[model samples]
Structures are given as structure tokens and as C-alpha cells.
Target: MPTTTALPPSVLISEVGPRDGLQSVSRTMPTAAKLAWIDALHGAGLREIEVCSFVPAKLLPQMADAAEVVRHALGKPGLTVMALVPNLRGAEAALAAGVHKLTLPVSASAAHSLANVRKTREQMIEEIRNIAALRDERAPGVKIEAGISTAFGCTIQGAVAEDDVIWMAEQAIAAGADESGLSDTTGMANPAQVQRLFKRLRAALGEHAGAAHMHNTRGLGLANCLAAYEAGVRTFDASQGGLGGCPYAPGASGNVVTEDLVFMFESMGVDTGVDLGRLAAGRAALANGLPGEPLYGMTPEAGLTKGFVYANGRRPATERLLAPLAP
Candidate 1:
């Protein structure tokens, strides 16, 4: 049997709660809960989080307080404040709010691109160009990341060619996106597909290639994430409680669950640096924030198995409680 080698010393779990998690839900989280959840996530040792989107408040009332959330999160020591920007206008707002990182979504599937952002892949690249110029002018120290959504497959276009995915990553980087990442928007990704695509993307974009954003629609979220990790991807995007989904794409289980993904990595001796118990506490805060929304995850429900030791060898309370149940 092959012995399991320890994973990297530290990995970044970029929380997508304020953006990916909130966008799909109908009820908007209260501004105070948003702040508290962000604080709790930071307390759980998550340094990076996509706190909000700089889109118009009318479009996503859920994130109407993007500036406030970004400002508040930025104040937390060592936290890399991140926010999404859909266009140049949004980028301006993000810059004004002093976000440490700004992400923009560019679709590889041309059909999906036209449907979601109402732009061709090429047009989206042009937008990246414009956004890049604005970033250089206003937020010189801030990072720009292009999140290439629907890179694996698309519900609208179907069969998003791998070549197109690679091409988009290269184009986005060339167009001045500081880094580029892949998002499996429709959740039609497999482990093999993930490993192959991330390998090709790394080869094509070099260091500019970014993290893998996956979904659990097919119950392969963790498997695909592991595949990507093996392919040399470092950062990952996950939502608290797996709350979001594409209304357009049926059965897509939003983003990967942060707690479960953290558990998978920590259990395998990978240092995610996130505290699962504190992450669950963050999720619990979500209930009061967005009442009646269903939060999904196995780790949070079944709890960690007995003797569950994290990568650092610390025993989680779940394991401690299994001490013969005080019989």
C-alpha cells in the first residue's frame, strides 16, 4: 500500500459566502450578520474571503452592502479582503472600498458567456482589458483575478470544449487579469476532467492560472478538488453550507461546501489552516441571517468520526466527545 504523503504546509480556503452563497438565496442576510459571519470565518483561520460583489444594489439586493462588508472585512488583521466585480463600474466600487483582491467572472463557453454576461468570450476579454486599466490607475496594489466560469461544461452550450477553456485562461491573463481560475458553474465536472483541465490550464497560463471552483451537484466536489490539488492548484473557492445554485442550471448544488472541503483536507494531513468547528459556528450564524434556507454538508451533520485528528494533530471536540460517551 502506498503511504500518504502530507499535503502542503498551508493552503488557502477562500470563502465565497457573501457572493456565491448569498446570490442564490432569496432572503438577504442582515448587514450585521454579514459582518459577524465574516468575523467568525476569519476567526476560523480563513484569511481570504469573497465578501461581496460590487454590482448594482438593485441587481443583487443581497449584497447591497458590498462596500460596508468589504471595508469591515479589510479591517481584520491579516485578512485578504476580496470582492467580485462584474464590470468596470463594479471594479471602481471595489477599488473605492479598498478590497485587497478583486475578481471578475469570464465564461469559457461562448453560449454560456452570452447568456450570463451578455458578451462573447472575446468581448469579455476586452472588458478585462478595460478593468485592468482601471485597476492599475486606482487600485495598483490590489490583485485582479479572472474567474473563468463554466470551464468544464455548460447547461446552455453543453460540451464546453477544453481547448476553449484553455484559450480563455490565456486570453484573460494576456488581457491583464493578474491571475485566472476555473469555475465549474454547472457542476458537470469529473475528477479526470478536473485533473486534465487544471494541468492544461497551468501549462498554458503558467503562474497566472488560479484556483478551481467546483460544485457538489454530482457528489464529486471533493474528488474533483483533490484532483485539482494534485494538478498543482493551490487556492480554492467554497461557500459556507453550500448555499448557492444557478437557477438556470437545474440541480447544481452551488459551490463546494467550505466545512466539508476543509475537513477532507485536514483529515488527509493537508494543512488548510481552517478550524472546522469554528467554520460550523460560522454556518450556524447563517441560519439566523437567512432564515429557512437549506445548508448542505456531511461533516457538519454526521460530525467528525471518533479519534478524528486534524492535520496539526489536535483533536476536534467531536472526537473528544466519543470518549466512550461517559459510560
Candidate 2:
């Protein structure tokens, strides 16, 4: 049997609550509340956040204040503000907002491509190329991420061929994207499949391979994340309270819960640069922003395990719990 090495000492947890989470909900969070949530998340030690998407407000009223939100997020020191752009027009607006990173979702499944963006796979790739050119001309220093959504299996078209996903990653990279990654938009991925696909993605893109965006729709979110970790994926995308889902993906659930994912890595002695206690506290903001929306997680409900030590060297949760009250 082959010996397995320990996971990396640190991992990047890119929070996507503001973009992916809010977009799926019908009620739009007020701009002030959105800013508060972003602030609370940043205070929890999250260095990277997908603040908002550059889409038409008429389509997604939840993201109407995208530019304003981006501007506020930029004021936070040390936070890498990222935004999702659908095409060249969105990319132009995102660049004007001075976002640090811009992610473009290019669906691997043809049916998903048509349903989500009303474009075929080839046309989307051409759009990505144009967006890349615009980025080079306007903001050469900004990073572009081509996130291949529905890379696992699509609800619209079942059993997306792995070859098609790999080809899309190659095409995105070849078209001038700075990085490319996979997204299980429909939450149909298993652990074994996660490991296999991510390994192939890394081999194909090498240094350009990016974050693993997994959903918890089928309840395999964390398991798939571990598999990806074992396969050499360091950056993981997650949302607070597991908010948000793909509008086109029937029965699709939200992204992986940020608190649970952070707890998983921290318990394994892997530093995520986030404070679990503080991260959980940010949930109050989520609740206030999207009142009545269902939030899900295990660690926040059960509290940290007994004698739990944080990755950032904070005192164990148990110790903090058992400590005598300070006068």
C-alpha cells in the first residue's frame, strides 16, 4: 500500500456568501446589511471574498449594488475582493469597479451552458477570450479565473463526460485566463470522482489550476473537499450557512458551509487563517441580512468539540469554555 502524506499546513478558504449565496435568494439584502456582513466576515480573518457579481440588476435584484459593494470591499486592507462577470460587458464593469479578481463561469455541460447563459460551449469560450483581451487592455494586473461550473454532472443533461470538462479547462487556459478551476454546481460529485477530476485538472493546468468549488446539495460536500485536498487542491470555495444554489440546476443546494469547512481543516491541524469563533459570529449578520432564510451547519449547532485547538494557535475551545470568569 502507498503511504499517504499529511495535508498541507495551511489552506485558502475563499468565502462566496455574498455572490453565490445572495443571488439564489429572492429577497435582496440591503446594501448596508451586505456591507456589515462583509465586514464581519473580514474580521473573522477571511482574506479572499467574492463580494458580488456584475450582472444586470433587472435579472438579479440581489446584486443591484454590485459596484458599491465592490468599492466597500476594496477598502478592507488585505482582502482580495473578487467578483463574477458573465461576459465582456460584465468584465468591463467589474474592471471599472477595481475588483482584485474576476471569475467567469464557463459551463462544461452544453445543456447547462444554453440554460444558464443562452450560449453554446464554443460561444462561451469566445466570450471568455474577449473578456481576457479586455482585461489585458484595461487592468493587466487584475486576475481572471475561469470557473468551470457543472463540471461534475448536470441536472439538465445527466452524466457530463469528464473529457468535456477537461477540454473546457484547457480551452479556458489557452484563451488567456490566469487560472481555471472546477465547480460542482449540481452537487452530484462523490469523493472518488472529486479526487480523480481534480488530479486531472492539476495535471492539465499545472500552476494555473485554481480553487475547488463544491456544493452540499447531496450532503457529500465535505467528503469531496477532503478528497480534493488529498489530490493537492489548496484553495476551497465555500459560503456562510451554506447559502445559495444554481437557478438553472434543479434541486441544487448551496455551496459548502464555511464554518464547517474551516472547522474541518483546523481540527486536522491545517491553518485556514480564520477564527472559528469569529466566523460563527458572522452568522448573525447573515441571519439579519436574509431574514427567514434557512441556514445549515454542524459545528455551529453542536459547538466546537471538547479540547479543540484552533489552527491559528488560539486557546482551545474547551479551555476557553472552562476558564474561570475574569473580573
Candidate 3:
């Protein structure tokens, strides 16, 4: 029998493609194809996936089948089905859908908050409080995560104050969020800022410190994720093929690529519990679902290094050493 190699998972990679990727695009993916793409992602060992958003169909028709998608995902054993919700009503809908988790989008930038969700940061926190209360009443098992968008910098309000971001995160937590994570909605985050902000977040929130949601708009997505990892962040939000962004937030495009981020960590001996080859199959499903749409990822295009070895004791037949290069 072949040796059973099981390296303990070092990090949690929450995939946001099924929701964010589809919502940002102009066309709606057929329900069958959406389910297939999700199956592919699950097949690739993606444990957590934000399958859809529970908003009004008029607002985001692409996510109209949120409940059906959640139902399909629920059939997958060991998979956490998550959905995005903006307000208490959305949370109720998601709870009804039987999702495993709910991620609420709360923009740290007041301007972006109003533009995206039509509410102020203070009001959003109150909404979170209500949503959490409802969750406690309806489905206590589901986790509620607050994703603070534009936490790094806002396209509408450039250069958001770091203090403001921290304050917003604290407010969300106090308002009853299980965890609060920051998002580079405009893709303006750098490695230094990422490290500093996440460090402060960990200190303030302690165990409540959440995932880093970085974008590849300016090509620093992977670097920022690495910085967050160094700052003790274990959960990361990434999209398949870099297919995600905010339609409300101008110039905010390209979520951190799932393939590249997984490769970055696994290559550095930090197990992401993701198989690159399997991930490519998921990518193919994504591409097939939305034909003619371009997908992006250096790891997918450049291919994994020869004799690559995963931190989890899995590797090619000719295993090569993975290490840092001498400067």
C-alpha cells in the first residue's frame, strides 16, 4: 500500500468565487453550471465556499438562485457552505437556505458603505447586531462573519485611515459579529500596510481576528496575503481565476487568485490543504461555465515548479526541496 501522507492543515482557504465571481460578471451563470463549478471546487478540496449572496433578485439577479445553490452545496460532506448577506433581511434568507455560514459585507469607508449598501457604518453595525440576534434565534450553529470592505483604501474615499478601519472592525465585533476581516476593496493595500493593520487587528480582536480579503487589482494580492500570514492570519478569502470585484466600488476588480495564493503558501511549507492540480480542474469548470471570459493566475499559466512538494507531505514522484532563495 502507498504511504498515507496526511499533513495537518495549517490554514483555511475560504473560496469566494461562486458568489463574488458570478455577481461581478455581467451574465448570470446557469444554475446547473453554477452547481457544477461548485462541485469542481469541492472536488478540489475547497472546504469552504461562499456559494451565493442573499440579496433582492432585482438588485443582483445573478444570485437569484442562492437558495438552490446552498441546497446543492449542503449535499457535499465536509464542505462549509457560506453565503453573503448585506442586512438583517438577507441574513434571514440565508438562514432559511440552511447555509453553514453567513458573511456580511460592511464597508469601512463610509462613502463606499452608503454607495454599496445604502447605509452608514454605524447603521451597518446595528444591522449586524440584529442579524446576529436573528441567527441566534433561528440557526445558532451558523457562524456570522463581518467582511469590512474598503478597509485598506476606498476608490471613492482614497486613503482610508487605518484607525478608522480598526475602529470599524471593533464596532462590528462589539455589535455581535463572530469575526471581522478587512478587505482591500480597491486593491490599494501593500505588504507593509497589510502586516501593520493585521497585527493591530490580532492584538485588538485576539481570536476574533479574521481572514485577509485582498484583491489583485494592482498585482500585490499575493504579497499582501503573505504579509497577513506573517501577522498570524490563517484564514484567507480568494476567488477562482481571480474572477471577483465590487460592481459598486469603481476600479475595484480582481480578487486574490485562489490558485496563486494556494501555491504561494504551499510552496512556503505552510499547508493550505489545497491541491494545485485539482484546483485547475475547478478553474476549468469556471471557464467552461462562462465561456469566452478570461481567467487569470500565474501558477495556472506558468505551471508548478518541477518536483514540487506540498507542505502536507504530498508531491510529485520526483520530490524536490521547497525553500527560500538566498539573496
Q: What are the Cα lDDT values of the candidates?
A: 0.85, 0.89, 0.87
Least well predicted 10-residue stretch by lDDT in candidate 2? 318-327
User: Model 3 off-target regions past 4 Å?
Assistant: 1-9, 246-253, 317-327
Model 3 scores a C-alpha lDDT of: 0.87
Backbone clash total for model 3 is 0
Cα RMSD, each candidate:
4.7, 5.0, 5.8
lDDT (tens digit, per residue) of candidate 1 on 1-327: 999967555578989987888877877889998998888889889989899998888989998988888878878999989888888889988899899998999999988888898988899899999988988888788889999899989888789899999988899999899899999889889999999999999999888989889888888888999999999998998988887845334454667889889988888888888878777658767776777677777777777877788888777765321111111
True-structure RMSD for candidate 1 = 4.7
| Cα error, candidate 3, residue 171 (Å) | 1.2
Mark the regions of model 2 whose C-alpha exceeds 4 Å error after superposition. Answer: 1-8, 247-253, 316-327
Q: What TM-score quantifies how close candidate 3 is to the native fold?
A: 0.92
Best by lDDT: 2
Over the stretch 1-327, how does candidate 3's per-residue lDDT look in tens digits?
899877655999999999988988989999998998899889878999999999999989999999999999999999999999988899999999899999998888989989987888899999999998999999899998998889888889888988998999999999888999999888788999999999999999999989999988877888899999999999999998888765334443488889888889888888887887777768777877898776777777777797788887787442321212222
Between candidates 2 and 3, the one scoring higher on TM-score is: 2
Query: For each candidate, what TM-score against the reference?
Result: 0.93, 0.92, 0.92
Output the lDDT of residue 29, model 2: 95
